[model samples]
Target: MTHVIDPAELKRWLSDGAEIAFLDVREHGQFGEGHPFLAIPAPYSRLEIDVPRLVPRRTTRIALIDGGDGVAARAAEALRDIGYTDVSVSRDGVQGWQAAGFTLFKGVNLPSKTFGELVEHALETPHLSASELSHRLDAGETIVILDGRPLQEFHKMSIPGAICCPNGELARRFWDLDISPETPVIINCAGRTRSIIGAQTLIDIGVPNPVYALENGTQGWYLQDLPLNHGQSQTYRQIDTPPAEAVLTRAEALANKSGVERVDSRTLDGWAHDADRTVFILDVRSPQETAADPVPGAIPAPGGQLIQATDQYVGTRGARLVIVDTDGVRAPVVASWLRRLGHEAYVAARTDLPAASHADETLPLLPEVQPADLFANGEPPRLIDLRSSASFRQGHIEGAEWSIRPRLRPEPNQTVVFIADDPAVAAIAARDISAERGAAFRLAGGPQDWEQAGLRVVATPDTPADDDRIDFLFFVHDRHDGNKAAARQYLEWETGLVAQLDADERKLFRLPGIA
Candidate 1:
């Protein structure tokens, strides 16, 4: 039986959580011209050698796709002979995805921003600017000119009525102001990403107020020839706390000593939105807390699991590492472990906290499925692994393409069944991300559940760059060797995958334009 999906509705399915597999049967050259994110390469010419290898699970919902109906039809029929129970041909193929106005992925990154129209995420907070405040203030509107510069700077000069709410204390002290959401809060700095981020911080953490940056910042106010007040700055020295700079500096100083790196939380929000983030993001909080809410692309691997899963976890070996957790307590421990392993670990610090101890960890890891399991079952029902990219590189199910974090791009209309080790975490991410264009699905028990159902797993060998005659896969299987021997094998294999892709001359003209 073949499964059909409307191209226009695919976005909805992805947003809603459907697990249908999309395969591009077109030739490498044809695919290179343009193709969808979820489309895996299984050239029709390799039907005899590759089809069975790539699609071991026959029961999956499959879309046999090509430049037109002809090759897709042939591939679909052959898949049936080989026991593929569900498959269908897209009436328009790659063209159809385009016709639907659905963004197509070109690089390893998915449909990118159109310069300005990139998605504005719900997880992030908003900021206000001086111009905005001036406009509102001039309009006789109730607005709070919350001066966010340091006490020294505030005493030097600031806008009229601008309260001495230092940028650093907004998280803790702003609460004392009783600023309502309706009252817009203006944030300012000497001029930098911090004050901008500070205003944004309150906005991100459920602060109901509309906030803005002082355009041009404190300088902007002066440039506009506005009045400046001095000696009215608020001081927190009597509170017996570390100065704001010292508090923010602790994260860096500790990181320097601990080797846990750092990333701008604001910019991270942008990367998280693009779906090109292939890093592993770990939150050391309890499972329940992580489930309640988390940074968009982060996974919960409490300190215990994080310690246990490090080597095989991909964050240590493959990609960059980021850490976030409850009040940043567990992150240092986790970061210490990864550092001992000689990995780069970073903390995605929470803007709301003065101490970085509550920061979370995020790193890219590969999927955890064996290659043999993938091809053993004849054809998978519907398959895709949703782990980090670093995880995908170590070892994965045979024929299971690296489609995990920052790499797994399912069409909106297709029902994509995701395989994650933790269904709860995946469910959370799926809930947040899948709601984007609409259409999404959860695999219930994830890869573990699939394995329990007698699915086989294999450690996939490196794929050649120009094996161009494949597409329309039914099932994607994976296997991971978290041990030393497996890791050694992976090091050798990654060297090869990189070399072949780099060496092959035909590679340029052969594969789709995706990275």
Candidate 2:
């Protein structure tokens, strides 16, 4: 049986310092709409796949809320089925919490976003308005603009002449620019969090250049009616040689200032053995270097991407994270950023750890039905495409319904066929669905196979069914066609998070002279 926890009781637990996973089991859209200040999104549709990564400890105390949409009860059951021992449903969910007069925040990544606002307010991080920056460029000023977003995002849209130098790359790869200290620098992203973090990274490390965040970033540029360069792809190249002596010295001092730990191989092993605390071993290096010397169990995440999308990597707050890199500059810089995000992050010393040489596992041996065979059946199976809602809407087998893995509910005599972009995701969905139904099958090569076989695909603007949950708000600009209004709302909402954060005492944002 599942236990129901009241809003007041849960709030008390948080106030009283209990270590619990306060999960909001709603779609990302619903989550972004409003949720408790500390609720981490764990969408019900992808619970089976996401829970292992988000809540690693099977024994951790977890409470699920879903605004009384019945998702919380379903998630609790799913958690128990997956061996999660201490799971409970939030009493009345988000609605009840609101009725009880607690704050419900808007937007995703509130933790990081709010911390960015706090950093700016506390540290008075400098900024350069898009209009002024644009004017400077137009007047032939030699300002160097560095886009702090990921390469893909920078490629999408950027200020003219802005080079892609993602957050941690300001330390790892900025030397390649070789510009004089007198040349003023500006950093930007689609919006606030990454740009703020990136600019602050430079400021914290005492970079000789005058670094400033492009106020409001590319969105601000668009709002100002400033021209943006699209599809431009100038990116920073990795420096294969050892970092310069000055870079290493500054990185060490910053890490010390931020209270980042420097651990060795033995310390990593000890943390790995600890049952109480969850530990994540990440190799913060460029893709090329890690590909050549991959650590056995360490997840290969570039320093910049890891800091930008931290929730994707480290699930649990307060978890121990040990970042690995050979040259030492990348790991320490990223570790310092993680420290600001309230993690017990460490930069691991260069040790002769064994690289992974094991053979990769073969694909799962699951029953496959070709598109031609599927269509030729006497009564065609009820196709259930297990891809994301967006992908399904873009194009899927005609008459197919979109569904998430492990949450499919088939009707009597209905034959369900799972399909996804990745065969692995399809296979996992097939396994879970087949366990409930007597049999399940997947498209041999997913949607691509269906298309290759000259089968018809359809597109629709319809949202997923009411029962379906949108797993993630993949982009910050994912609202109302990503228009100016949505961008403006996002920017305004972000700036206001600091004030809301002042009321909530749970956040542990440590900035210079403020700890």
Candidate 3:
């Protein structure tokens, strides 16, 4: 039996300073449109896979919410099945929270986005409009543009000639760029948060160069009819030498100002042994560095992305975060931002920790059926394509019905065969459907296998329709797909987030001069 928690009580639980996993189990589209201020999205489609990482401690208090469609109940049952001892569902989910007179924030990464806006307002972070930068470039100005987004995002689209240097690496890699101290620097991201944060970081460090964030970032450039380069490989190179002592001192002072604590491996062990507290050990290094030599028992969370998307990495609000990095530079920089974001963040003094073991629960494998065997009898088994709706629309095995984990519906006692890109999704869905649906089998391979076997494949451009693509967030993504109105709306949304916060929500941020 599952317990029900009302909206007011759940809100109180969040602010009580205890570790709680407040998860919203709705799809991405629904989650992005509107959700509670601190709710982390753990969509029901991938509940088991995401919950373990988000809330590592199975015994932690977990509160699940949805759109009052009983999805929370289903998710609660799933978590309980996976060894989560303390689980409860929101009384009526988001609808209940609204009725109780709480704000439902629009957009994801609420805390981080709001903090970015507050930082700009408080610090008066200097910025340059896209037109201003463009004119300067045309005049042969010696300004250097640094794209503060990750390399992958930079590869997708960036200002022509911009070099990829993520915000987290800006402090450590700034000297390696070999630009003159007098040269002006401009930092940009897809939108505002990273650009502002990156620029403010340099200014705080007291660099000699003139630094300015590109206002509205790439979207601002697009609005000005500026060209963007795709597939660019320009990025900061790895340096053999360590950061300068002055740089390290400045970073450590900034971390101290934000109330960041430096802890050694023994201290981390003590925190891990505490049954009442939840501690997340995150390695705040570059992906390549972590892959080459990862710290034991640490999840790799690249610093810039982690600060930008804290809810994705750290699900348990108010929990202890131990950021690990080999260099003294990156961890402190990342921890300072995290502390201001209202998390109890600390940097690891050393990186020698014992490896933690994870539960290896296995899912029952459904029998596999070849394409020829799929239609051996007179009638074919009900073919359910569990691939993404977008992928299904691109092309799928002929006569296959598209469905997702949460929305699967099969006839009673029906023979079913699942075609999916990820076998795990199919296996989870197979375990979910009513047992009376008879035995379930997966296509030996996906649509590609069927195509290889000379089976018919079909495409339906308008099959799922825009509304049914709940897995994708069109509100945030449409701006990238050449939607001018969406781009403007998104910018407006980003600029207006700070004003939407309630008193309690606003109090979470501890910016300069704010008590």
lDDT, candidate 2, at 131: 89
lDDT of 3 at 449: 76
Number of colliding residue pairs in each model? 112, 0, 0
Q: Give all candidates' CA lDDT scores.
A: 0.48, 0.76, 0.87
lDDT per residue for candidate 2 within 210-317, as digits (tens), equals: 999889989898889778888899988765788789989999998998898787667666666667777667888777778999777677888877876676666665
TM-score of 2: 0.89
Task: Name the best candidate (by lDDT).
Answer: 3
User: For each candidate, what TM-score against the reference?
Assistant: 0.26, 0.89, 0.96
- List, residue by residue over 1-515, the lDDT tens digit for candidate 3: 87999999998898887899999999888898889999999999888878988998889999999989888888899898889999999999899999999989888998898888899989999999999999999999999999999999999999998999999888889888998999999999999999999998888777899999999999999989999898997999899687889989999998998899888767877887888888888888899999998676788999998989999999998899988788788889899999988999998854455457554456666778898777888777888888888899999988898887778754557788888776677777776675653478888876677888888999999988888888877775778667778889999999998777887787788777544
- Stretches off by above 4 angstroms in model 2 are 15-18, 350-366, 404-413, 422-437, 446-448, 451-454, 463-482, 512-515
lDDT score for residue 296 of model 2: 73
Candidate that would win on TM-score: 3
List candidate 1 stretches off by more than 4 Å.
1-132, 235-515
- lDDT per residue (tens digit) for residues 491-514 in model 1: 233223222222211121211232
